[model samples]
Target: MSGLTVTLQFSGGAELLFDKVKKREVELPALEKFLPQINKTDWSLRELLVWIKDNLLRERPELFLQGDSVRPGILVLINDSDWELYGELDYKIHNGDTIMFISTLHGG
Candidate 1:
């Protein structure tokens, strides 16, 4: 019950790779246990991506992750703002933050 709480949303084709779930509430470990490599006091979106791929992703992970980042054509928004404005993967994930993923590759 004591950890970083955040909301994850998947849209377009992104949800397809996540068991068709559109929204998820995740509780990440404290800063110390989240990702100690970068900063023991914070967790970055980069680490969150890896965590999601390893923990939440139910199938076809490659469709959502590529290398150290999200697959191409997937747009990410953090707290209602484009992640690019906050350094994308480098952005620090805060408690109560909302992260959304939309796959533009989905067919019309």
Candidate 2:
């Protein structure tokens, strides 16, 4: 089966938690690649979040996530628009989509 391809970007110190990767071009595997409990033919940002945490996050998961979504203060943009405009975590993952995570949190 053809894989789903997309672009991922991290910025505003968010990249520090993801091996300092500012951008990535990824090819998501088939449905089997998603969490075992998930059953679907399509991918969503929710699944993408978990996938990123599992495959790309380097450390301190709590800094980036809370429950099933991004911790508060983290801004998510889909194709340059606010993720909230597209149903946030429920937003479907589309090929060539550019998903960006920007951290608005800072530590003293």
Measured by C-alpha RMSD in angstroms, how accurate is candidate 2?
Answer: 1.2
Candidate 2: where are CA atoms >4 Å away?
none
**Maximum-TM-score candidate:** 2
Candidate 1 C-alpha lDDT tens digits along 1-108:
248899999998899888899999999876566565654567789888988987889998888889999999999999989999999998978889999999998564
Put down candidate 2 lDDT per residue, 32-62, tens digits, no spaces: 5565576776888988888899889999999
Global lDDT scores for all candidate models: 0.87, 0.90
Candidate 1 wrongly placed segments (more than 4 Å)? 34-39
